[model samples]
Target: MTFSIKDDSPLVSVITPSYNCSAYIKETIDTVLDQSYPNWEMIIVDDHSQDDSVQVIQSYEAMDSRIRLIPLANNVGAARARNIAIKEARGDYIAFLDSDDLWLPTKLDEQVEFMKSGNLAFSFTSYSLIDEQGHSLAIEVKAPQTVDYKHLIGNTTIGCLTVMLDRKQIKHIEMPDIQPEDTALWLSLLRNGYQAHGLPKILSKYRIVSNSTSRNKWKAAYRYWKLLRVQEKLNIVEANFYFTKYAYNAYNKSRGLQPVSIQNGGK
Candidate 1:
């Protein structure tokens, strides 16, 4: 399939927020450099990392003009760093890749084709899990065929590293300064009459770092409930309903079992 259907290929700006990820940052950058799609720029925003992460990223900047680094003066956070990169992004399409994530060679090409052909404004793909040492765990999380605001309230399966958004379709893209900013952003878009379609292809690898935010399931679930009530303004009844469903899916995910599938719709 053709990657860019249009005559003028739209540039895809890959936004990555880095924070003391020196060990895996180089591998992440190499994954982007090896993508089959050519029209892309990788913008790495360092969130005041104390390690050699900045030095490692700087070493790659001289090699390719498409790779650019934005060092923050203060250590804000991942949400703020990603927001800064999004605001400065020059590409028509915005793709997100975390500092430790790895993308397959055809990730961009196939996803771009999928979005263009379906006329989708937002899209996300399934991804496999990897250990800290970059060894595949063979555990893949599949995204639902489609998700709306309410659909996502229960199951937040869209991985940040596997998502791509069309800037022309959604304006004023800013992730909320919350624990799970990516999910909040997707929920905001879906609530604003946008639908996030899922590409079933496993096109990315999510590195499960030890002591990561996601590893803390209890805290994450609490934050998810808070987001539903505070950010989405769901009432007590509505919040309780979705929070229960969210907890169930979280349990399944923790056990390496499939979360509530779209077919089941959390039934």
Candidate 2:
């Protein structure tokens, strides 16, 4: 399962939407800078952060040419901020990394190799959960080998930070201005005949803060339902069916029942 990435590897545009994540933005930036894959640019879109997040990002950008900062005058939202970055991205591949999230060094290397080897247009990797203080909770969400629109409807395990899309193959893929916008984008691509292959490696770290949307299960469910019924416009029965499966998966992942090794071929 070893792969090699050359110096002239395909350029990866890493997009990050920042919103008052000063506490953890530095480490996040550091993680990206330390990636084993060198041919990449990180666009950290700041959504009018009220803290020192921008300062931290700027400090890093000052040192590294690969790191760029897009500061918004007014606070829009995560989806909109990401869209702005997407519009300006100049790379063969599009990748997402949130401000508070962390990526392991080999993330880009492994994922890019996986996609290139399999001729995959879209792909994601498994990620572990971290607490607000950056302590591992020993919980990892597993990703399936391959998922289409239908499979995604029943199992929404694709993490935004773990996802990498081949823009050369799939074009005009933007995050919708809605709750769970990332998921919406994934579904839209899959619906349009793009299958996302999962690498199943723990290559990213998702930080769970108290105010995180994932913490509010009921609210998250409601927003997901809205995404299905309103944004994507699935029929009531289809929406309910997908929503039910989503709820079950969410419950299981919350309980740490679906560990990374178990889902990723017991690796």
Candidate 3:
């Protein structure tokens, strides 16, 4: 219950990739500013946005030294942008947030306390989905208590915005250049005998932008299948099995139905 642990060092470093999200990045940054947790720095890497997002980010950076901006010379994808921030992060804990997404006021404080109290290396939380204009979709995805590699392979329940990782535990900290880079990195770690602790608290908000890459359902499914085969090197039968479960969970979330919980252990 006591989130007032010591703040001797920068406890959390937030990594966010910004593109053409000038309209929403302000709100996204504002959420961090409002967090009850004070010992944190935000590392935002702008992926060569054409819009005035750089100006918006700069204004905030000037206001607070904790908010730093890394403007890219050329347009790299989100994976590379996030990797850049990861390389430069100086905090003990690393967290991810997209320019269009948001976090609750106590997100950093509560999650940090949970990880520290339980001695958890990696953790994620449930989140609420919001429409493009910041309207809630009226659905909250509840995270299971814990998810090992097997459960995560079938159910992609860990939102990137809700993740917090211990820097010391992560031997490597770069994300692969894949469609779902966040999931890919999580899988890589989980596969190496690491379990991602899930906090059932809804501490973040994920925005459903109409024009994002995930809008095309069929393409997204195919990309996920490819990720399993190419990244995980899974056989046809194994890929099909996990893909089926992934599809089912995706369907459940799309319809506002909760994804089935993993029991004391996964299936």
The C-alpha local distance difference test score for the whole of candidate 1 amounts to 0.88
Assess candidate 3 and give its lDDT.
0.89
Tell me the number of clashing residue pairs for each predicted model. 0, 0, 0
Quote model 2's TM-score. 0.92
Over the stretch 51-113, how does candidate 1's per-residue lDDT look in tens digits?
A: 999999999998888899999989999999999999889998999999999999999999998
How does model 1 score by TM-score? Answer: 0.93
Error of 3 at 197 (Å): 0.7
TM-score of each predicted structure versus truth: 0.93, 0.92, 0.94
Worst 10 residues of 3 by lDDT: 1-10
Off by over 4 Å in 2: 1-7, 259-267
State the lDDT of candidate 3 residue by residue for 189-210, as single tens digits. Answer: 9988889998999999999988
How far residue 137's Cα lies from its native spot in candidate 3, in Å, is 0.7
C-alpha RMSD by candidate, in order = 3.3, 5.1, 3.3
Q: What do the candidate models score in CA lDDT, each in turn?
A: 0.88, 0.86, 0.89
